[model samples]
Target: MFFFMAKKDRDYFLSFIAIVFLILHLHVSANEEADRIISLPGQPKVAFQQFSGYVTVNEVAGRALFYWLTEAVQQPSSKPLVVWLNGGPGCSSVAYGASEEIGPFRISKTTSGLYLNKFSWNKLANLLFLETPAGVGFSYSNRSSDLFDTGDIRTAKDSLQFLIRWLDRFPRYKNREVYLTGESYAGHYVPQLARQIVNYNANTNHKINFKGFMVGNAVTDNYYDNLGTVNYWWSHAMISDKTYKQLMSTCDFQRQKESNECESLYYYAMDQEFGNIDQYNIYAPPCNNSDGSSATRHNMRLPHRPHSAVQLYSGYDPCTEKYAEIYYNRPDVQKALHANISGHIPYKWTACSETLNRNWNDTDSSILPIYRELIAAGLRIWVFSGDVDAVVPVTATRYSLAQLKLDTTISWYPWYVKKQVGGWTEVYKGLTFATVRGAGHEVPVFKPRAAFQLFSSFLQGKPLPKS
Candidate 1:
């Protein structure tokens, strides 16, 4: 067909084709430069590209959310996109999720360097960590009042907007299979965000390729969570018989508000149960220098205090949180991450924002109803618990699932990783529940290999290994 064309016309068509190709090439090149992370301070050499910056969700308010993305270790273009959130209701996914748990690197023991995290989730997916709600981590809002005016509904709306803008910035991920995963309060964040995405898809021309979501040690139903906490403490023999009796007799789990006597007894029981230990992982040692002043702060679930290199079970570092705080605050480090570029952020970065936690509003008593809706929509849902986490224990999660009354498709059984039992799992009609053995509130930080295996199975939509 080309040979049949007149010589001048054929040359003209060839030139047009060349021009189109050049334009396409330049488009990709521009995107690469715009999102490229030059380098991170003290970062180890790596094969994958990383990017960090703000995606403005509201231009008028100067509201932006911070994100750090690590492309998959291999064939990133073909892999799924996994967004991870950490649940303090005010936690920084960058500080907790990225630095200490599942990102490509962890703060070195020396506190001044970085080291490779062999079990980084990006090995199998393009992992994204978001610091959301406008006041956590490096995310910020220009309006001072906006920092304190955040809640579950507002956070979800802002997060949906952040995702839409983020996709515009990194358009390559627009069509990828998207999965939401988070721990603790993220139990609330993940479901709410998923619901918003579903609603957006239903109403708008632009669509998100939403697949499924996974949560660990999540706060789902306050009634079950509180009840389970008491039961867990009693079962673990952490509380006295009298305290247990008081909890059972005086505290009404079903009540929206408990009596003064019940509140007193509950606090007493918690004090007896936790003492000076790290409540997130009962068996793990508390940060040596911690004075226990933050013990009553539930939102500060995984507080890290600097300590000596005394190894604990699973080689978990009790001081990783402190190390992350120091690393993130370094001027050069912030510059490398493209964080706090405006110099207008009022506070230094912390793993969890105390102000945000105090000001949080519009919390739903239970997210179980949202779960039910998502399940019926046929989205693959998996709920996991770190068995050693007392903050939101496995017992609480189990009780919450029981309330849903989803019939078991597969009976409870041990799941394996590396020829060893990593956890126990059960498949229900609409969800899968699993427990990670010997893990704490942050499963990946406490049991990296098992956590990675669980993540791999979830992304593949396969049941955990039985052998």
Candidate 2:
């Protein structure tokens, strides 16, 4: 009763998702080969190479789209190609995934630069980072007009196309076990991307290989993830009564409408204090544009841009103590202080432009059908979350997946590694959901060990690890 999404309403919600997708696909995405590759701005000590290129997807026809590819220092055993996406509906995978989360390097404290992390995920698989939906990160369109409105449709299209081109780039991995992994918004991104991959496979004779997918603290269902994140924070003492009531009284997130009082009250609450920081975290309140009048400018809540964030860490500055440690830093990160980033270490803090995000229906109802379709296709599907992550908490996923009613609960429980608890795991029918402990929206940042475990487990197509 508390989390009431009526069956009729849910059904309608889902139907809308399918219709939007059907309409978008029917339109026929523009298909011209636009420029794909872009250079890394400032050339630093070349520990590795990061290249930008386009994956020709039908959704964004005539545009190559931008994607960042990070290779491992050592060779991966023709393993799986794990594509990483950071959520924001428009977040950039390169900045968050490559720099902050599991990518090989973490920015130094003194400089807004990169330092090698001993436990980056690249050690396990070939990592591909994307600045999807065009206009994210360095990917751009000459026609500012082109940046008009971006939606999940174009995003999935770009991802599918990028996969094709990526395979072309590394033809060897053409049939490799391809796993899509991401955090927060990627919950939505990964499912859709996986669905598209399946769709592509079904449509064409040239079958593209797909192994599985992993989502960490992903935004699975808007209604639940949004509400659960807030309630979780309150239970943890992040927000006070004034703010909670403000939210209750003023905003209707589902309806996409808000009152001035609600907006004012919410910001006042945020002004109180952010919750516990996690290595992998998303902006709390699920970023409903606490920043402005329109959703267009609503997401700029970062204490500062990405570089400034890392820079603050250099001195261990603890820049925004008001927010959680993960959301903000105190005393900053240790290495970001000394990295050489003057010329071109292109720093993209917030991925995806709000201007673009607002155009399409972010709340995609098509996923249920998409999920049903994918499972029917034999593609391994797994959705995992960081328990602490309010953004895409496990609860939202649980609610969404409940509808699937798989054949049976294969085996559901917790997973552990080296005798250390990673998180809880649940398998029903064929779908699996694992909740990583002490992790936020971004699972890898807070719990690298668990993150790697989750990655490795799914990559092997084995049952998710058990406690």
Candidate 3:
């Protein structure tokens, strides 16, 4: 067919093709600019820029993941690009990581405004908060079945696609040093995605300069996590010794399906014996108004902080998620964020998705193998815990990491922030473990300054200050 064309006609057709390509390129560039957020409602004046929108991960599936990128506060081009995910296996990074934890702005109590977080991670790096798995938060899919069928593998694959396609939108970040950070179930997410990037970079021209990952209060090994969790409850005096013995004897932590005896004792320990204290933070007061449903959700792995204010962290607002829900659900807020443009969400914005949580299909019982693989790959892996969190407690993290049997480079010692003992830390041959002294499951929320210091050290590849 090509050989049949006249010379002049071939040149004309080639010119037309070039013109169409230019138009398409301009259209995409325009869409990128369209996603820029001039300012969120009630947002304080800031020098840095913000952008939020959806990146379609699976065109055939109509699955698009929402991302909010907060550029670094100073010399953005020179800063690294840090990607953050919050773990519910089905959670909104926007609600928790962005609005509450590490993002630049915190939603005010009135839900009418925002304020600066002095410890925003973006102060040092270009922070990208992603709401993943297609059904969490503002991220959505036109295909209904995609929501019901979610798992670690699919989530990681989609996130890799998101990062790849997202780079097409913001090409400046293509070669930037990237680090994956998350907490809780992201213990699975951070490492899994890092593994995906490692494989992808090996096989393809499209590479993500993924340096390492850091997860706080993360769920690593089911066996070790459950074992350590039971011990933490007993040692912390949260549950009766009898219940602890029952758990240890009846439950096989490696078994995905527990025996009836194990299930019963587990519920009893959490429901009856653990009492009304906030499981996320043992010493902190529970939200009086919360029905306490979150504590029992998906084996108590969900964030248990609820819709009531608490005085920790200098007025650490437990209700920040609530405020986030309110603010993001507003039509104005959605429009500004360039979210839900298709009007296909069919639900209010939430910090976490109960449907995805319940139906999550394939969870790797342990992520430790991936940790080993990535560690050998020489990724800068750091695992930290908020000591007070009973759910996925520090003991659980310690137990899980000990299974690695890595050589210790530094003995355990207190790491200080402003002359106060912030937490304890130990450096292994390839990984670092640290604890936030009084923090809960959400370290940045409970100890922002310390969390920031920890993040700074991670990026700089420096030891935590010993003085």
Badly placed stretches (over 4 Å) of model 3 are 1-28, 290-314
TM, every model: 0.90, 0.70, 0.91
Instruction: Report how far off residue 232 is in candidate 3 (Å).
Output: 0.2
lDDT of 3 by residue, 33-119 (tens): 889998898999999988999898989989999999999999999999999998876788988889878999999989999999999
Per-residue lDDT of model 1, residues 246-336, tens digit only:
8888877766457788877866766655576666777877556566443223322211111111113645666677787899999998888
| TM-score of model number 3 | 0.91
Worst 10 residues of 1 by lDDT: 302-311
Q: lDDT rank, highest first?
A: 3, 1, 2
- Evaluate all candidate structures by whole-model CA lDDT and list the values in order: 0.83, 0.58, 0.86
In angstroms, how far off is 440's CA in candidate 1?
Answer: 1.0
lDDT-superior candidate, 2 or 3:
3
lDDT score of residue 296 within candidate 2:
16
lDDT of 2 by residue, 1-467 (tens): 52488888888888999999876544432221122222222224545444444554443334545555565556665546788876665555655677667877554544334456666777777788876766665455444555676667767877787788666655556777778888666667888989888878878886787867777666555455455555665766667766766665665544343456655655566444553233124332222224532121222221111111211212222222112222212123211221111211233324345555544444574266777877887778788877765444566677667777786565667689778778888776667778887666566666777788887778777776554
Q: Which stretches of candidate 1 lie over 4 Å from their true place?
A: 1-32, 254-259, 290-314
What RMSD does model 3 have? 4.4
